[model samples]
Structure formats: C-alpha cells, structure tokens
Target: MTTAAMPATPADPGAAEAADVTGRLDALDDMLRLGGGRLDPRLLDEAGALLDRAGERLRLSGEHTVVTLAGGTGSGKSTLFNAICGLELSPTGLRRPMTSKAHACVWGLDGAGPLLDWLDVDKRHRYARASALDTARSDTSLQGLVLLDLPDHDSIRAEHRAEADRFVTIADLLVWVVDPQKYADAALHRDYIVPFARYAGVTLIVLNQVDRLQPEEVDDCVADLRRLLQAEGLADPRIVTASAASPDGVLGFREVLVDTVAARRARAQRITTDLDRLAERFAGQSGADEPPAGVPAPARAALVEELTDAAGAPAVAEAMESAYELRAADFVGWPVASLADRLRSDPLRRMRLGELREELRNAFTGPVGAQQGDVDNALAAVAETVTGTLPPPWARAVRAAARRHAGELPEDLGEALKDALPTFNQVPRWWWLIKTWQYFLVLATALCVLWIGLLVAYGVFGAGGDGANGLIGDAGLIPYVAVLAVCTLGMGYLTNLACRNMVALQSANHGERMERHMLDSIERVAEAKVLKPIADELAVYAQFRKDAAALRG
Candidate 1:
C-alpha cells in the first residue's frame, strides 16, 4: 500500500517580514552606537529596548500573529475571548477582574509553543477545525492566529495592569473589548486609544456586552465610540458591537478575525506600524530631512584668526622680523658695530625659538596656556554657526562634538607653528657679499693708520740725527699721507651707510616671507581642530537622517 505524505506545513508567512524588520533594527543599532553621545540618551534607550523586544518576538514565532484582547474592569473581555475561541479557555466569573495571568488560545499548535513561552502565557489551549467532531470541514482561515486573554487594563492590582501593558506592546494586533457603560471612559481614551493611534492599522475596537443595551441605544453608543476614536486621531476606525453571552453575538467579531487571518498580513502590518511610531518620535529632531550646510565662510575665517592668535603667530612673526634684522647686522655691519652685535643676546634664542621650532618638527607637543582660551572661544563660535539651523537635539550634539575636537587644539596649533619655522630660518646670499666688502673697508682703515704712524716716527728720528732726511720733507710726502688717511676714513663711512640700507631691505623681505609661513601654519591648525570635526558630525547626521527616512518608509 502506498501512503501519501501529509502536505508539509506552509512556510511561515511572516518570515520575510521578520527578516526585513530584523535587518532594519540592526542597522539602527549600529547607527546609534556610532552616534554615541551625540544623540539624545533617552531616545537611544527607548530605541534599544524596542529593538530587543522586536527581536525576541520575531524569533519566537514568525508563523503566528499574536492578537491581544485588552479591556478595563467589567468590560467582559474574558467572555468575548472565550466566545471567539468557541471554548472555555478563560475564567469569566465574579472575580471583579476575571483574568490575571494571560491565557492564550493557539489555532494551530505546530510551531506556536515557543511564541507562547516568550509571551509568558502559562495557560494555553490548542484548537483546530480538522479535529472537530463534525465531518464537514469548518473554515480554517484563522489557522496561524494566537489569541490572548489579558488582565483588565484598569485592574486593582498594579501587576495586572503592568502585565496587560507588556503584552499590548508586543502583540501583532489588539482587540479592545469595551462594554456599553464604559465605552467612553476617559482613562481608556486618553491612556490607551490616543497613545496607540499610531498603531491604528493593527487595532480593532469591539463594543462587547452590547446585549445589555436597547437596540436603539446600541447605535448611539457605537456612534459615540466612533467620535471618540476619531478625536483620538484614529479616523474612521474599525468598530463592532457584540454580545458574547448570546450564541450568535460573536459571529461578527469572528468574521473580522477570519478576514484578518486570511490576509496573513498582520505580522508585517504590525512591524510597519512600529517603524512608523519610531519615525514619528524622531520627526522634529531630524531637522529638514536634508544634509546640513557646513560652517559659513565668515565664521571659518574668524575661527582661523582666533586660532592664529592663540598659537602665538603674531609673536613668532615679530620675533622673525627682529631676529632677521639682528642677524643681518652681524653679517654686514661696520667692524665696530659687528663686535657690538656679537656681544648682544641672540634675538631668536631670547624668544625661545628652539623650543618653538622643535614643537612644529614633532607632532602636537606644545605647552598649553592662555592661548587655549582663544581657541575655545573660536570653537564655540564655529559650533554655533554650523548647528544654527539644526534642531535643538542635533544642535546640542554638534556642540558637544565641537568641544571634544577642541580638546586637542592647543597642542596641534603649536605643532603647526613649529613646522613653519624652517621657512623663516633661511639666510640671503647678499649677506655674504656685503660681509666681504665690509672686511675690505676694515683692512683699508687699519693700513691708513699704520702708514700715518710710520711717517711721524721717521720725521722724529731724522730731526735728531743727520743720517736720514725725512721722506715727507723730500717729496712732499706728509701732505700725501694726510690726504690718503682722509680718503680711507671717508670710504669706511660711506661703506657703513650702504651696508645699513642693504640690511634693512633684506630684513623687510624676510619679514614678508615669515608672515606667509605663519598664516599657512594657522590655517592648517584650524582645519584639523575646527573644520574637520564639524564635517565629521555632519556626515554622521546625514547617515542618521537617511536611516530614519528608511524606517519611515
């Protein structure tokens, strides 16, 4: 005999939906972690909790769509739950709040046990149309549904209320069973209905125990409930009236469930609702939904200027000017002035030039001081400029990022300045040529003095004895010596004047070169310490905004 294998159970309809939600949540977690302190801590915490719960729910049952029956005390939620399941699955006596711990009724037991376990529902019953005593098959449209009978939302015990809230958060669908008398309860409308308006797609409102009301009164009650739902932001909500005590009262409620199950879209719809809620939470905080414009040009220029001052650019440039002038004097000054220049302290050394040069050659290792204050002020200004158009939360995040970037400013600025020192340390070739001319002028002056002295000595010796008649008297050499001495002195004075002008011109050129180097160094520091951090934050914000938009979609 050939035995036909029973048809394999169909794959869980929600598997693809669950996977998509899981991937989105993982991406969100990564984005939040990268954002770190730059995002609102409270929002981050809320998002993390939601992600964890979603993961747990998805893992437990991608085949079953968990629907919760929630209502206030005396709302007959338990009776309605039993009527819908066609069994005595929930206690419905005079216990004030009939249900305490949640009771679940699984339409098909296969692959649904783990979902019940995750939901913490210890009381569970399995039902299937195929196992019914009647030979004729009943409708099996609700095959993968898990219906929950939850404790009253307004129970006297806080734990009962808390339990109701917990299930409500994770359930794929919610059926609010309100009695006619309590249909317009302020607590129900304000606390549950309005807050869950974003979840309208997965919600159903049933007016249970409507058999207690007159036929004429039922219309008025449902109309009143509809108005309240609309006021709470659920425009044109799905609302029905049923009397679970009556045999046929639950048929209407059952038909809605059958339709819901037939579609097999509750799981995907529920996840989509959750994403919508999250996107709403981040609505205002994400700003204009476009990439942020970076810091303004004026603000950037101002920041550079402030940083330059803080890094001692002005002091370094002035030192360069003085040092150049002094150095030039040493190389090209008159012999007498050269000696004085050597005796004086070196200008660059007196200004701590060696330390500054070393700081630039190495990385950021400069001493921190008053200059840091300027850097701080400039950073604050830039932060304000860059984040000015952002929402308050994002602006605060950007500001915090700016502060963090500025922490390394002082050292970085110092290093930049030091790196620029080599540009100003160069010597001009004209200095050496001027020095050679000055040396010749010195030699001529010395020779003239020697010549005059020897002539005077010969005249004195000749006057005492007859051996030598004075050369000065023989060839009018005394006048010639006098004229030569005067010409040598004049030459020395003129040479000294020319050397002074040359040194001054060289000093001016070196000063201009030093200024350019100093400005360039400051610009580098500004880029590292200010502009780069703002750009990084903008990039992060852009990614976050994109993720938010995807979630919304």
Candidate 2:
C-alpha cells in the first residue's frame, strides 16, 4: 500500500502526545543499539552521545505521548500499524513489493530519537511540538494519543531489519501484531518480542484482520490468543482486534490502546506519566554524578586528532606563510681523481641547503618542528629519534657527497625512503626529502658554477692545457655532462637554480609548517575534535547521575 501522511487539523493535540511517546521509544531504542548496559565503552559512549543530542528536544517538544507501534512483516503489522494510528489508507499501489521497503513511520507527532540518522536518512519534513491541542495541526497528537504505521520489517536488507528491531526495542509503548496464519513465526517471537519482554508492560499484541472469521466468534479467537501470550510468559497481555481494510473493529481497538489496558499496566498511565519516566531516565543519565556509561574524554579527543592528521592538511595549509634572510657562501673544487665524484655530489649540496632552511623555520616557530639545515644533521637527529641513533651529521654529509653525482630526485627517491624508513624511521619521507633535496641541489650547483669562474679568473682562465683548462674554466660545465645532452642537462640545472633560490626563500619562511600541522592536529585531537563528543557524553552522564541522586534523595 502507498503511504500518505495524516491530514492537517485545526488543533492537533493528538500528535503532540505522539512526539513525547515516540521520542521516549526512540531513546530506549538508542540505548539498546548503543549497548548501554554493556561494558563496551564505545557503545556506551555512543549512548551518551544520543542522550545529549535529544535532551533539549525531549524536554521542549515531545513530552506528552503514549503508545508507539512497531513490528515485523507478515505479522499483519502494517494493517495493525495503521489501526493504532487510526489513519485512513487506500489500497496498495499497482507494483507494491510483497514485502514493503520504505518505512511507514506514523507518530502522533515528531519523534524523540535520532531515528533519521540511524536510518542514514535526511528527512525534509518539518515536525514540531504543538503547544496546545487546539494548535496541533497535522500529525501532532495530544497526551495519551497513540501513533501507528508499518515498518519494512521483513525486508531482505539488514538495514531494514535493524530499523524495525531498533524501533521496536525503544518504544515505551509498543504493540506486536500477529495474524492467525503466521502467529507462531519464530522471527517475531524470538527476534523481536521474547528478548524484549522486560518491556512487555508497554506492549500490545493485536490479532489483526480477525474479521475474516464469524463476527460472533471473535471473542473465542481473542481468548485463545491471550492464552498463547500467557504461554509466552507475557504478563496480562492486552490483545486487541483490528481490521485495516474493514475499519469496523479498529475504533474499539484504538480506544483500548489509548485507555492503556494492554499486556502491561504502564500503557494505562496518561502520556504525561510516560514522559515523566523518560525525563527521569534521561535526567539521571545527564547528571555529573551519573555513571560514566558514555565515551571517555581522552579517547574521543585522540580519535579526532588521528583523523585530522591523516589528511596531512595542516602542514599543507601552513606552507602558504613566508620568511627570508641572506648569507654569503663559498665553493671549491677537489682533487682531479675525485673531480667527477665531487661535481656529481651537486645534489647533496642542495639537500644540505634545504635542510638548513627547514631548520631555520623550526627555530623561528618554537620547540618541536621540522628543522632545516644540512639534511645530514636533521636526518641524523630524526634517525636517532626513530631508531635511537644514526651516523653523525658530518659523516652522513660526506657519504651523501660521495654518492654518484648523476643522481636525480625522481631516480633516488625510492632508495632514499627505503633508507629513511627502517634505518631513519621516516614514514611518508620520500616526497618531502626529494623536494627539499632538489631545491638545495640546484642552488649549490649554481654557486659551484660561479666558483669555477672565479678560480678561472685567478689562474686557470689564461693558462690552458690543450684548451681543456680554458674550456672547463670558460663554460663551467662538468666535462662529461656537457658531452652528452649538455643543453638539456644545463637547462635542468639552470631552471633548478632559479627554482631553488625561490624555494629556499620560501622554505625559510614556511619550513616548520609541516611540524606545526602535525602538532596542531595532535592538540586538536586531544582537545576540540576528539573531546567534543566525549565531553558531551560526560556531561550527559553527569546530569543523569545528578537526577538519579535526586531521585534517590
């Protein structure tokens, strides 16, 4: 059958009562799902979370409602769900599924629990508490009113089962529908009713569509049904007659529901009585003295930090900052035997330079950050932190310089991280190291080029051997690199130089940005993002504890 909402009324007090009762049912359902009675702190924390979100809403809006209907399919539950709410319905649509899917949630008004989110839903309808019965418009019901509707309880989907099971468990006032045909369905009694018998007092069992029998013999069938419930160990279960299609037995059934003489005695209390019980339950949960059933503050805080850090967002964001300073430097060539090797170490020089800039920024920011200045030094320090010790900076510097000069960032990256991770304790190291290394290398190479020119002017320029000395001094290109792809390599080297100078300045300004990002993420993880839910839970527990204490007093 297609679902349609209740028609608006002049002053619908019926729905106001609905909100209060439905909200309480929602609260109980939330508690059950969150494992409120268990030691699993995560579930309890979630429970505490639920309490905080709905507290104000509970207090202000739906505090005067009664019975809430929920059950499974083939249980004749939809016919029963509608009978309880007393909402009229049309025949099923042409292509309705044998098992309904969309939940037909009928509350006297807006419900109490975070039912929407748990449903993974975003409801666009507006539902608010009507201040008075006369003011109650469409769905809003008054105290002692009942809400009815079908749930897609028997759907193949797990989500549907969860939704139905959850709603059934939480309702302060609930009805379980069973037909004569499938009255003994194990899923109904075992999956829903039996385990929740602790809540049987608020329950109603309806033998719906009983009008199919001889009208005069309805009483005998209802009697046999009551005996079955008694066999099920339900206390004085209230059995009602309902027919969605016929509409004859429903009015009588509705009166019994609102009058509250069902299976349990609690339903008899007016909607206000139920609301008071709820306020009592939640108020206790909210108090400072309440048991710490919700999330521990520290754990929640930590989780938030972890999530933020996962993005590496802080460092990326902070690098947009700037700082600058200048200093003089010198370069010199080594022995001819080592000449090729030394020139090849051009990348090492850039690495060292980048390391320097990063350290400077760290110094500027404060304690605990990425330090720039000599990759040898910082790498050693970080390595020590990661592995407890590493080679000294000077030795590392020498080794770096000793590496094949042909090394380029993209080529060496894989190996560098391999070394950095296990030995140096670097996680996510390659990109940063490669970037820093490139910037530092180009700057050093440029400076080295300038040094060769100075040396030439002093002695090597005018005194040439077979034009080789003059060639080396004048062009200032490494002899071998110049021989093959010199122009391409030269352009790379020159562009690298320009880019390095700019990056060097940029790094100087923003070197600690990464470290800052990591630190701030940790702090927020400890504080706001993580702590918010936990603190909220603690607050609920406190309020609950206080209320419990007051009740005890």
lDDT, candidate 2, 1-553, per-residue tens:
1134324322433355445455554554544443343224553555454454444324433333334455545555555554443443312332332333323332334443444333322243213323353242222223334343434466666766665665553444676767766666777777666655445556778777676778776787888777766777677887777776665667656666445422223422233343344444444233232234333445344433333343333443343222121211111111221345557777765665567546433432322222123222322332222111211321232233222121221122222212221111222333355445544555555555555554465335445544444435554444433343334335445544554565565555453554454445444433432234334434443443443333222
Candidate 1: which stretches are off by over 4 Å? 1-27, 123-140, 289-293, 337-370, 405-408, 422-430, 459-475, 478-488
Q: Pick the candidate with the highest lDDT.
A: 1
Instruction: Tell how far residue 66 is off in model 1, in angstroms.
Output: 0.6
Model 1 quality (TM-score)? 0.84
Worst 10 residues of 1 by lDDT: 128-137
Give the clashing residue pairs of candidate 1, or none: 360-418, 360-419
Q: TM per model? A: 0.84, 0.36
